[model samples]
Target: MPVVTYTLWRLSLFAVTLVVLVWVGMGSWLAIVLAAVIAWALSYVLLGRQRDAAALHLAQRAKPGRSAPADAEVEDAALDAAERERGAA
Candidate 1:
């Protein structure tokens, strides 16, 4: 799935989980606080993996340029292109 779709799905699941947890007799304040903490921690873990995946996706999308490590070369080319574009406008 796309990153945005996956992220939305994960957030919806987390919301549902929190609702279920509170419905099962946990006190409102406690449930809310605990759920927030757990969601934050889980997001922290998942977001790292998501960021790495996004970086890899971007590297793959970059066009081939000079001969070096493919990702590094692509990154260099992209940077150069960005710099030239900025200089022009």
Candidate 2:
């Protein structure tokens, strides 16, 4: 699953767990705090590997000097020209 979908799933699970805890009379404020901590810990433990993989994928995709085709150079020149025109105007 995508990182976003995984995250949302975890969040919804956390919410349901917290609601159940509160419904069981675990004290509203304490349940909220404990649930947040537990959710964060569980998320870190369970999703750490996937998060690391996503980070690595992004890092590889962003490897230097590998982006865009030669057309990017033309785009840059056009942008520079537009900037110069704006300054002159």
Candidate whose TM-score is highest: 2
lDDT to native, each model = 0.73, 0.79
How far is 18's C-alpha from truth in model 2 (Å)?
Answer: 0.6
The stretch of ten residues in a row with the least summed lDDT in candidate 1 is 60-69
- Which tens-of-lDDT digit does each residue in 1-89 have in candidate 1? 44675577557657876897788988988887777777777767767777567666667656565334578677899999999999999
What's the CA error at residue 63 for candidate 2, in Å? 4.7
Q: Pick by lDDT: which candidate is best? A: 2
> What shift in Å separates residue 57 of candidate 1 from its native position after superposition?
8.8
For candidate 2, lDDT tens digit of each residue in 1-89?
45566678578768977998898889888999888888888878888776776677778767655675466677899999999999999
Query: Candidate 1: TM-score?
Result: 0.41
Candidate 1 overall lDDT versus native: 0.73
